[model samples]
Target: MTGLSPDARAWLEQHGFIPTDDAVWLEALTHGSFNGSGPADAADYQRLEFLGDRVLGLSVAAWLFRAGDAPEGKLSQRLNALVSGTTCARIARSIGLPEHIRLGKQARDDGGADSDKILGDVMEALIGACFIEHGFDTAQGLIYRLWAKELEGDVGKAKHPKSALQEWAAGNRRAPPVYTVTDRSGPDHAARFTVEVSVRNVGNAEATASSKGEAERLAAKAFLERFG
Candidate 1:
């Protein structure tokens, strides 16, 4: 049970991915919570998550470069939108990553499997494993395939949800959006933040992410979805 489940294997197969090191992939799907009482050496996804972040960045950058002749600023915006924790969590949820995630009892009880922070981190860690065990080409292939729809058209058209949320509040004559950090977890190198965004007399929403800023943005997006 410490390894991949049958559903995970089938999911990988459906995506045409055959991992060379099951251990690495398993580690990629693990959360630090899973190691709370285990051996000190028990590996989790943190290190892999670090590497995967860079890999995904590089892959997306390259795609942006070849995709069009937009200026660096436009490409940067598109890149940020594409690789944001929001996008990662969406992809993770789409690929059924939550069910495969390994978490401690407390984390599982806290809904860590479906958490944006955990899902996004594990998604990057999986990419890192792919890059290490296979190569950049393999990782790029995976990225390209999964992100085709996002890469299809003008990805630069979307406004950042934070700005949009604030604008919505102003337009509706509600109080400005207020963000509050509800919780933080993980080590200093990779902190996970949970933020709540509220607009008085309007609505409130919460989200979790790798950084406070990202968490705030996600919370804003959730708020928009609920009552923008």
Candidate 2:
């Protein structure tokens, strides 16, 4: 079997993760859909995904342990958000990891390469590969490198906006913010909502999105950015 390409090796090196077994790295990049037409022994990323999930959790837990004076509950909540499927998918996209996956013809035809589930699984597989190749410290370092920006942002946005805004208003001896639906339209498959958020003593901001939840989040973010 051919060893890992120089470009792949360089990519790992640049990320400070070195793989001792290039085969494992290759396997981690392989999707099950690809094995049928090519190499019979080529394993998929499933097993690696399992291992990577644990590795990611442990690394994030260790980071929270060292970096915070917050209570366990708060840390756990933030950790949950950070490790969510959406967050994982976002991180996967940020690293351009989806571009390196080897998928089968069927998978390629179906656009599985860009599927969030596949990308998330591949991310875990990469973590698993890193752990097996470079050990804990290297894997932890790599996770932190990939997710540090997300982690930092999460810390600031940790409090669910409505609650945070309430606390801010109460602390300042002002009234709480109110959310009003300004516009609601769109088809059943893809509805849109627009919400206006006004603080009792502060100003007002509007956010529009595909879902009420998203619209609320955007409105809250806007309110915080404008007033808080």
Candidate 3:
């Protein structure tokens, strides 16, 4: 109701995602924090998230199985990387999923609508909703369309900065880089972190990010790029 339009529906359908139940679609877009009064009042996306996570895992696993020539370990690693929170968030953003998310006033006011975590969860929920409305084939088709770029091109290639850093460190025989939070600032609700990454023998590099985890990842990536 809030974000759905004929154009949006047509776009999604053309991309292989068909939602038979509009209410389910809306629920998939709703955030849990917005459902203060419970499911009867406002159905949230948590259940759909759970279902979608499993569906995505299964779909990716099936894809790897059919792709061929990949070892179990390699396939597992690729699956993990592809399904990571960052990757999912990126996919959500690419589809403009955040624009369709249904957040409560508080969440909208606090910028929760644009949050990667929320967007990622909602993306999963959308997948789950599609799966329920149609089936695995439909859901997988949609996922493939969304992820074709990442999956079709060098499926096992390590592209992320963090992964690149680890590979470089291991190759150079230096103790793996170490990341530490050097500083934290901002309000309690929206804190930012500065991270410093020190390679065993190389100099330290620093980066700032909205979250400590992200900052550490960025710092490690920067250190690897500069010194690895």
Best by lDDT: 1
Instruction: Candidate 3: give its CA RMSD in angstroms.
Output: 3.5
Candidate 3 clashes between residue pairs 3 or more apart in a chain or in different chains: none
Give the clashing pairs for model 2: none
Write down the lDDT of every candidate, Cα atoms only: 0.84, 0.78, 0.77
Off by over 4 Å in 1: 1-3, 37-40, 153-156, 161-211, 218-228
State model 3's lDDT: 0.77
lDDT of 1: 0.84
What would the TM-score be for candidate 3 when compared with the true structure?
0.80
Candidate 1 residue-wise lDDT, 1-228, digit = tens: 355677887877676567656788878877888887554555899999999999999999999999779888778889998887878988889878888887887778767787777888888998899899888999999999987877886554587789899899989988999999999987543568999999988779999977899889789999999996
Candidate 3: tens digits of C-alpha lDDT, residues 68-120: 88888788878976776667888888877776676667666777766666777
For the record, the alpha-carbon RMSD of candidate 1 to the native fold, in angstroms, is 5.1
RMSD of 2: 6.6
- For model 2, give the 10-residue run with minimal summed lDDT: 184-193
Candidate 3 residue runs with Cα over 4 Å from true position: 1-15, 36-40, 159-173, 183-193, 210-213
